[model samples]
Target: MKILLTGISGQVGWELQRSLMSLGNVIYMGRNQLDLSQPDTITTTIRDIKPDLIVNPAAYTAVDKAESEIDLAMAINGVAPGIIAEEAKRLNAAIIHYSTDYVFDGNQNTPYRESDLTNPQNVYGKTKLVGEEAISSIGVNHIIFRTSWVYGLRGKNFLLTMQKLAREREEIKVVDDQIGSPTWSRMIAEITAQIVAKFQQNPSDFFSNKGGIYNLSPSGKTSWYGFAKAIFNDDFSNNERKLQRLIPITTQEYPTPASRPAFSLLDNQKLSDTFGLKIPEWDQALKLVLDS
Candidate 1:
């Protein structure tokens, strides 16, 4: 199979290169090659490649910065997805897109399901939801894996931020109220590869009854503070950081322009039922990333 992948420089995309190598002839494209902001560019590139599958791990993920870059965010996160879906439909190809848990407001006490109502509280979430809608509306064979708290070895994510802060400052203050699964990008890529391989074996069976939005977060959830502590304790040997203390603070104390969901835990039962894949808990996955 010929595969076209976007966002080759992102955390998940970086790992996807390794995970998807054995699947087929993989073509990797960064923004310079196939800029999502330009619909014409995306159309030209995808048509030229004519891939059997399109895997989109690229997204405008700046939560707070998206508030100021609404047009760019919408173009990439909202409009670009529809463009890709349209092209994929023409080529009789399938797509696997990654979305986020921010689509819902933090009102539910339990984990969110695929059918949960989406009321994005921030611009980033709203735009991502638009992407999901665009792909689904196209009626193409697709799987939208909505994950949360994604981080990896190389990326401007919470893990790297906390690791840097731990080394630079003696005390680190993190928000204690906001909660998520803290998924590793490598895990996401690996699971995606597995699903793709499975789909290749039975395309009709997979897309007929199983293609849809499925929560792909780690099994367990934790506050930002707890997540940071896990990183220090599990990721580091001998606690070898300059961090002396970790202060748990409220979201109000460290306000940002983008509003965050207080609890954005996603339920992964549908994923298990469909793909027979159940991601491990946050702590377990963190160890795998750190060890690698």
Candidate 2:
């Protein structure tokens, strides 16, 4: 099978290169090759490749910057998926796209479900939701895996930011109000490959029954401060860094251009029940990321 994978330079996309190798010939494309910002180029590139399955991990992922760049964000995150979905439908191919937990307003006391009413609080979230709607409305075999608090060894993420800050600064202040599971990007890609393998093995029944959205995140939730503490304490379990302090602060104290969800945790029971897959706990996953 031929698979067209976008966003190969990104955190999830970078790991997908290794995880998806066994599945098929992955035609990976980074920004220079498959720019989601350019709609016509997106269609042209997908058509040119004519992949059996299109896996889009690309998006306008700058949460704060998106507040000022609405049009660009929408073009990439909102409009691109529909265009790709239409092309996929034309070729009778399947699509697997990644989404964010920010699609919800994040006010719910419990973990957000796939069927929850979406009320995005920021432009980034709003655009991502638009992408989800676009693909769903296009009537193609698709799987929207909405994940949260994604971090990895590579890329600009909370884990890397903390590692940098801890070394340079003596004290680190993290927002404690916002809460979500810190899912490793590698796990997301591997799980997706497993899903794709299943579909390739049984296309008719999988799409006929299981073609829709699913929450793909780690098992538990934690505040930014909690995650930072884990990073420091775990990473420095043997070695040394700043060897310093962590101050937990409220969201109001640290304001950003884009408003984030207070609690963006997602329930992954649906994904687990459907795929018989489960990510390790937040702390355990962090240890794994740090160790290997």
Give the per-residue Cα lDDT of candidate 1 at 6. Answer: 96
Please give me the total number of clashing residue pairs in predicted model 2: 0
lDDT per residue as tens, model 2, 11-116: 9999999989899999989999989988899888888999989999998899999999999999999999999999999999999999999999988999999999
Candidate 1 per-residue lDDT over residues 1-292, each given as its tens digit: 9999999999999999999989999999987888999999999999999999999999999999999999999999999999999999999999999999999999998999999999999999999999999999999889999999999999799999998887778888899999788989988999999998998898776787789898998898899999998888734434557778888999999999999999899999889887777668889989887787
What candidate 2 gets wrong by more than 4 Å, as runs, is 234-240
Clash totals for all candidate models: 0, 0
Per-candidate local distance difference test: 0.92, 0.91
Model 2 clash pairs are none
For model 1, the stretches where C-alpha displacement exceeds 4 angstroms are: 234-240
Whole-model alpha-carbon lDDT for candidate 1:
0.92
**Worst 10-residue stretch by lDDT in candidate 1?**
233-242
The CA lDDT at 273 in model 2 is: 93
Candidate 1 collision pairs = none
